[model samples]
Target: MSSIIKILPDHVINKIAAGEVVERPASVVKELIENAIDAGATEVFIDIEKAGTRLIRVTDNGSGMSKEDARTAFLRHATSKISDDADLEAIRTMGFRGEALSSIASVSHVRMLTATPGSSSGVMVEIEAGNVKSLADAGAPRGASFEISHLFYNTPARLKFLKSAATEFSHILAAVSRQAMAHPSIGFRLTHNKKPVLDLPLSMSVKERAFQLYGNEITENVMLFSGGRDNVHIHGLIGRPAYSRADRTYQDFYVNRRAVKNASLTHGLYSAYGDMLMRGRHPVGFIFIDIDPALVDVNVHPAKAEVLFRNQSQIHDLLRDVIREGLRAHGMPVISTPEATG
Candidate 1:
C-alpha cells in the first residue's frame, strides 16, 4: 500500500475557493461590504467602474487594523473573529469564516491602504495575481480602503461569464441597497464611475431602512417577528401575502448577523406562506437567526453564504411558526383569497 498524497499549494486552494465565492461582481460586492460591516464601520462607501470588471474600490470608516493585521488579513483562514471550535459556536460577529479576503485576492489585483485612528501612517500592500508585489508605509486616511483593479484578470474564463456593464452595475447596486436596508444605523453610499447612485444617511430604524430601500408597498406589508426557544432565537421581517416576489432574490437570511442562504429554512418560510404565493412566486423578507454557533457550520460553503444546522427541523419549525403568526396577525384571509372572495 503506497501511502502518498500530494499537497496542494496555498494559491491553488485559494483559487478553487474563489471559484465558489466570486461568482460575479455581485458576490464580490456582498463579501467585501459584509467585511466592512463586521469591522464596526458606521459608514461605508463603494465605487465601481465598468461594472466592477475594471475596478472595485471600497472605503470604510471602521475600526481599521494595524499594519501587521492588514498584511495577515490576506492569508487563508487567518481571522481575528474566531480561534477554535468553542469560538465558532457563539459567533457574535459577521465574519468568522475568513475566506472572503483570500478568495478575492486570489482572483484579483488587490491594493489595500489601511490605517487606524491616531496612526501617523498606514500600510499599503499590493497583490497581483495571488502574488505580493510590494508592501510599504504610505500616508493615507484612517480606516480601510481597498482597490481591486482588473478583477478576474488572472482568470479570463470568469471574465467571459460576466454580464454587460449596465446589468452588473445594477446587481451591485441592488446588493448594496440590501445590506444598507439591514443595518439602518450604518450610513452607506455607492458611486458608479464617480456618479452617486445611492446615498443613505443612517436610517432611524429597521422599518425606516426597509421603506427607504423598498417602496411603501413592501414596508406596509411587512410583518415583524421576534422569538426565542432554548439556545436558538429568530428575529426578522416577513412580507404579508400582498407583498411577494417572483423569485427568492428578495429573501435574505442572516445567522448571528452573518448573511447566509439556507434553502431548507427558505422552504419552511414558503410552506408557512401557504396559498398566498403561487408555485412560482416567493416572499420578500429578511430572516435574522440566532443560534448556538457550535450547532451550525459556516465553513461548508466557500462563499460563507451558507451553513449547516444540527437541528434543522427545529429551526424549520421556528421559522414556520413565526411566519404563520405574522400572517395571522396581518389578518390574512382564513380561507384562500379566491375562495373567500367567491
Candidate 2:
C-alpha cells in the first residue's frame, strides 16, 4: 500500500475545530461578545436576523485592533491574550486560545472592521469559507464590529442540526443575558429581525443589573450576600425561599466573570436551601465565585464554559455555607442538617 497519511489543509482543520467552538448561532454570539469584553468594551450591541441563520452582528466600543492584528486574527492559535506557558497560569482574559475567529470564519461569511484609538484609518476584511475575499483600509470609529452571515453555510450537516428560529433566538438571548449579568457595568443592547429585544443601560452593581433584566419582582425577592474562605470569594444575590422558581432557568453561576455550568455549584446551592425550598422548586439567583486563576483551570473546555478547580470539595462546602449563612442572617428559618461536602 502507498503512504496513506496526509496533513490536513488549514481550511479543513478550521472546519473541524469549528465543530467544537461554533455549536450554534448562540455559540458565535458568545465568542464574539467575550472578545469584546476582553477588549475592555464599555458598550456592546448585538443584532440578529432570521435567528442568526441569516445574520449576526456584534459591535463594541472597546480597544480596537491594529490593521496588522486584524489581518492576523483569522489565523488559528494567533492570540494576544497569552504568549507563553507561564502566562497561562494566570489567564484572566475572556479569550486566550485564539481559535474563535478562525473557527467562526471557516464556517460562515465574515466581515470585520476595526480601528484603534490613535489610528488615522481603519481596516476592513471579508472572508468566506476561511478564504480572505478582501482586506482594505477604511474609515471607522475606535472600536470593532463583526458581521457573520449564513452560519454553517459550508457544512450542510451542521446546518441541519440547528433548532427552530424561536428556539435558537432564546439561546442567543440567554448567552447575551449571561454576559450582561456578569459585567453589570457594561451597557448592552440586543435586536432581532429589526425588533428591539433588550436595552440595558450601564448599571453600577449586579443588583441594579438584575432589576434591569428581571424587573422588580425578581430583584425584590433576592438578597445580596458577600463572604469568602480559603481565598475563594463568593458574592452575589441569592433568592429567598418564598420566591422560588419552578426550574433552574433563573439560576446562573460565574467563576471570575466567566459563565459556567457546574454540577457542584448547583448541588451546593440546592443543599444550602435544604428543606426550606418546596419539593420540585428550585432557587433563582446569580452566584459569583472568585478565586486565584492558578487554582482553577479554564482551558479544560474548548468553549471555555467550564473550569476545573484544584479543590472541588472546598468549593462545594464554601458555597453551601455562604448561602446558608446569608439566609439565616436575613431571619429565614434554616433547617440544620448534616453538612454534605461533595
Candidate 3:
C-alpha cells in the first residue's frame, strides 16, 4: 500500500458530515429552526409534505441574510457565528459549526430566498448536491425561507433507513415542541401535508409556554425559579412530585434558549427530587439556562444540540438544588382528624 493520506474533496466531506447532522427529515427540521432562531425570528412556520420525505420548507421572519451571505452559506465550514478559536468558547447562537446548510445542500435540492429588512430586492439561490444551480434577484419578503426537496435523494442508504411517514412525522413534532418550549417568545407552527400539526402562539411566561406543549397538569404543579451568578441567568419551571412523568422524556432542558438533552443535569434533578417522588417517576418541566456567550460552548455537536458548559458541575448542582429547595419550601401538609362521636 502506498504511504499517502490525501485530503477528502469538499463534496465528499460534506456528504459524510451530512450523515451525522441530517440523519432524517426531522433532523433537517431541527437545523432549519435553529437557523431561524439565530436570525432573531419571532415567528417560524415549518411545512412538510409526505412526512418531509418529499419536501420540507421552513419560513421565518427573522433578520434575513444579505445576498453574499446567502450565496456563501452552503460552503462547508463557512459560518458567521465563529471565526477563530476564541469565538468557540463564547458562542451564544444555536448554529456555530456552519455545517447544517452545507451538509443539507450536499444531500438534497435546497432553494433559499432571503432579503434584509431594508433591502430593495432579495436573492434566491438553488443548490443541488453541493453545487450552486442558480443565484439571482427575486421578489421576496424581509426574511428567509428555505425549501428542501426530495430529502435524502443523494444518499440512497439514508433513504432506506427512514421509517413510516407517521413515525417520522411524530419525530418532527417532538423537535418542534422542544424548540417551542425553549423559546416562549417565539411563535412556531408545524404543518404536515398542508394540515397543521402544532400551532403554538407566543406566551407571556415560560409556564404558559410549557402548558401549551405539555398540558395544564404539568404546568399546574410547576414551581418557577430564577437565579444565576455573573451574566448567567437560569429561569425555568419544575413540576411537583404529583405531576412527574413515567420517564425522562418529559423533562426538557435548554441552554441559551437552545433545547438540549443533558444526562448529568437531568439525572441530578432526579436525584434531588428522589426524597419526594417515588420510583419509576420522572420530572415533567422545562428549564432555560442563560450564560454569557463566552462561557458556554455551542460547538459540541453538528446539530448544536449538546452544549459544553464552562462550569458544568456548578450548573448541574445549581439546577438540582434550586428545585429541591422550592419543593421543600412547601413543607408536608398535615391532615386534621375529626373527633368521633361515641
Candidate 4:
C-alpha cells in the first residue's frame, strides 16, 4: 500500500492560511492600509463598494515596488520588513509576517499596480485564487494601488460568515479611524459606495486630528496629557469625570503607533479614574504609549493586535500615575443642571 501521508499543494496551503488573516473585508482593509503606511505613504485613499464584498481599493503615495518585487510580494513568507532573528526583537513597521498578501490573494481577486520613484513605467499583476492570471506594463503614479474584489468569493463558508453590509462598513470605519488617529501626519480619505464617510488632511497634532474625526463635542470635553519615566513615554487625551461612556468602545490604546488590546493596560486606565467615575462607566479617550521596541513583543499574535510588555507592572503604574496627575491638574469643569440653567 502507498504511504498515507501527502503534502498539500501550494494553492491549498495558501487558502488554508487565508483563514487566519483574511477573516473579512475589514481585515483586508487593515492589511493594505498598514502596508501602505509601512511603505512611507503620506496620503492614503480607501474606497469600498457594497461594504467591501464587491470591491476594495487602497491607493497610496509611497515607495512603490519594482516589477520583480511586485511579483514576489504574493509569495508566502516573503517579506522585506525583517531579514534575521534579531530584527524581530525590534519590530517597528506595521507588517512583518509576510502572510497578508498571500492570504488575501488566496481568498479574493487582486490587481496590484506599482512603480518606484524615478521609474518610467509600472507593473500590473492580476491574481485570482492564488494564481497569477496576468502581468503587464501599466501606467501609474510613483506609488502602489491595490484593487481587491469579490472577497471570500471562492470560499462559500467564509462568505456565509460575513455580517450585513452596514455592519461590516462600521467595522471598517472604526479600523480606519484608529489608524488615522494613530498617525496624525498621514492624510486619509474613506468612501463607501460612492458616498464620502471621512476625509482628513495631514494634521500637525493629535488634538486637531481628534477634533476632525470625533468632532468638537468629544474633543472639547477631554484634556491632553503627556508624561513618562525611564524609557517609556505616554501621551494622549483623557476625558473628564463627567464625560463618561457606557462602554469601552471609546477607549483607544496604541503602543508605538500600533493599535493593541491589553487587559492590564485597560484596567490601569480605569483605575486611574478612581472615585471620580461613576460605577460601570468608562472613560472616553485615546492613549499612545512609546517604549523601546526590545521591551515589547508584537509577534505573540497572528493579528498583531495583542502585545506583551517586558515590564507590565511598571508600565501600568506609569500610565495610571500620568493619567491621575493629568486629571488633577486639569480640574473637571462643572456642568450646570437644567433647573440652574433655567
Candidate 5:
C-alpha cells in the first residue's frame, strides 16, 4: 500500500475553519460586529433579510482598511492584531486570529468596501467560497462595509441545519444586543426585513444604554454596583432581588469589553443572591468585568465567547462579595447562608 497522507486544499481548510467561526447567521453578525469595534467604529448598522439566510450587511464608520490590507484580510492567519507569540500574552483588540474574514468568505458570498478617512476613493473586494472574484477602486464612505449573502450557501449540509427564520433572527438580535451592551458609546441599529427592530443611539453610560434598550422600566428596577481588588474591577447594573426573570435570557456578562459565558460568573452571581433568589428564576442585569488583559485569556475559545481567568477564585469571591454588599447597601434583604457569610 502506498503511503497516502495528502494535505487538504485551501478551500477545504477554509470550510473547516468556517464550521468553527461561522456556525450560523448570527455568528457572522458577531464576527463582523467585533471587527467593526476593533476598527474603532463609533457606529455600526446591521441589516438582515429573511433572517440572514438571504442577506446580512454590516456597515461601520471605523478606521477603514487600505486597498492592500483589504486584499490580505481574506487570507487565513493574516492579521494586524499580533506579530509574534509574545503578543498573545496581552491581547487587546477584538480580532486577532485573522480567521474571521477567510472563514466567513469561504462559506458565503462576501463583498467588502473599505476606505480610510480623507481618501477620495475606496476599494471593493468580491469573494465567493474562498475565491477572490474582484477587487477594484470605488466611490464609498470613510469606513468599512461588509455584505454577506446566502450564508452557508456553499455547504448545503450546514444550510440545511439552520433553524427557522424567526429563530435565527432572534439569535442575530441577541448577538447584536450583547455587543451593544458591551460598548455603550457605539450606536447600533438593527433591521430585519427592512423593519426596525432595535435603534439605539450613542449612549454616554451603561444606564443610558439600558434605557435605550429597555426604557425606564429597567433603569428603575436595577441598581449599580462597583468594586475591585488587585486590578480586577467588577461593575454594572444588578437587578433587585424582586426584579428577576424566569430564565437567564436577560443576564449579560462582559469580560474586558468582550461578551462571554463563564461558569464562575454565574456561580458568583447566584451565590451572592443566596436564598434571596427565587428558585428556577435568574437575575436580570448586566455584569462587566475589567481585568488586566494579561490575567485573562481570550484565545481559548474558538469564537471568543468564553475566557479563562488566571485568578478564578479571586474573581468569583470578589464578584460575590461586591454584589452581596451592594445589595445590602441598597437595603435589600439578602439572606446569606453560612457559606455565603463565611
Candidate 6:
C-alpha cells in the first residue's frame, strides 16, 4: 500500500500554525507590539481599522532589520532572540518563538518597511499568503513599520470566528494597556478607525502609567506593595479594600514582565485580601513578580500567557505575605486563622 502520511507543504504548515499564534486581531497586535519592545523600541504607535479586520499597522522606533534579516524574519523557526536550546531556560526577551511573523504572514497580506539607523536606505517587503510578492529598496525612517491588510483573508473560516468590531477593539485596547503598563518607559499611541484612543507618553513610574490608563479614581485607592525572599521579588500596586471589583477583571499579574493567567497567583491575590474583600468581590490591582528566569517556564502556552513556576507554593506564599502586609499598613483588616488567633 502507498504511504498515507505525507509532510505538509510549507505554506499549509504555516496556515495551520497561524491558528495558534494569530487567534484574532488582538493577537496580532500583541505579537507586533511585543516584537517592537524586544527590538528596544522607545515609542510604538498602533493603528487599526474596522477593528483590525480591515487593517492593522504598527510602527516603532527600534532596531530595524537588515535586508537579509528582514527577508529571513518570516521563515519558520528563524529568530535572533535565541541561538540554541540553552537559551530557552533563561529567556528574557518578549519573543523567541519565531513563529509569529510566519504565522501572521500566512493568513494576511503583509508590508514591511524597515531601516537600521546606520543604513542610508531601507527595504520594503510585501508578502501575500506567505508568498513574497515584492522586495525593494524604499526610503523610510530608522525604524520598522508593518502594515497587515485583510487579516485571515484567505481563511474565511477564521474570519468568521472573529467577534463584533466593538468586542474585538476592546480586546485590542486591553492588550495595549497591559503592554504599556508592563513597560512604562516606552511611549505608546493607539488609534482606531482614525480616531485617537490612547496617547501615553513615556513614564518614569508604573503608577504614573496607571494614572494615565486607569485615571485617578482607581490610582488614588491603590497602594504600592513590594517584598521578596529567596531571590524572588514581588512588587506593584494593590487597591485598598474599598476599591474592590465585582469580578477578577481588573486583576493583573506579570511574571518577569510577561502578563500571565495563573490560578495560583490569582488565588494568592485573593488570599492577600483575605476578609478585607467582601464575598463575590475581587481586588483591582497589578502585581509583578520577578524571579530568576530559569525558575519559570514561559513556554507552557503558544501565546506565552501562562507559566510554570519551579516553586509555586513559595511564590504564592510570598505574594500573599507581601500584599497582606501592604493592606495591614493601610489600616485594612486581615482575617486570621483560628489557630493563629488562639
Q: 268 in model 6: Cα distance from truth in Å?
A: 0.3
Summarize candidate 4's per-residue lDDT along 1-342 as a digit string, tens digits: 989999999988998989988888988999999999999999999999999999999999999999999989999998999999999999999999899999999999999999999999999999999889998888889889999998998999999999999999998999999999999999999999989999999999999999989999888888999999888999999998898999987789999999999988887787787677899999987999999999999998777789999988888878887787788778743322121100
Give lDDT tens digits, candidate 1, residues 226-312. Answer: 776888888778887766778776688878666777878887777777777877888888888888887887667766767888888
Candidate 3 regions with alpha-carbon error over 4 angstroms: 1-3, 331-342
RMSD of each: 4.0, 1.0, 6.3, 5.5, 1.5, 2.2
Top TM-score prediction, candidate number: 2
* Model 6 error, position 241 (Å): 0.8
Candidate 3 structure quality by residue, lDDT tens digits, 111-131: 999999999999999999999
TM-score for model 2?
A: 0.98
lDDT of 6 by residue, 137-179 (tens): 9998988999999899999999998999999999999999999
For candidate 4, the lDDT comes to: 0.90
- Candidate 2 residue-wise lDDT, 1-342, digit = tens: 999999998999999999999999999999999999999999999999999999999999999999899989999999999999998888899999999999999999999999999899999999999889999999989899999997998999999999999999999999999999999999999999999999999999999999999899999999999788777899899999999988888899999999998889889998999998999998987999999999888999988888989889889888898898989989999876877676
After superposition, which runs of candidate 2 have C-alpha atoms over 4 Å from their true positions? Answer: none
Candidate 5: segments with Cα more than 4 A from true spot: 335-342
Model 6 weakest lDDT span, ten residues long: 333-342
Least accurate stretch of 10 residues (summed lDDT) in model 3?
333-342
How does each model score on TM-score? 0.89, 0.98, 0.92, 0.95, 0.97, 0.97
- Between the candidate structures 1 and 2, which one is better when assessed by lDDT? 2
Model 5, span 1-342: residue lDDT tens = 997999999999999999999889999999999999999999999999999999999999999999999999999998999999899988888889999999999999999999999998999999999788999999889899999996888899999999999999999999999999989999999999999999999999998998888888878999989988888889999999898888888798899999999988898998899888779878876999999899999999889899998888888888898888889989988766645321
Model 4 stretches astray by more than 4 angstroms: 1-3, 332-342
TM-score result, candidate 6: 0.97
Cα TM-score of candidate 4: 0.95
Better model by TM-score, 2 or 4? 2
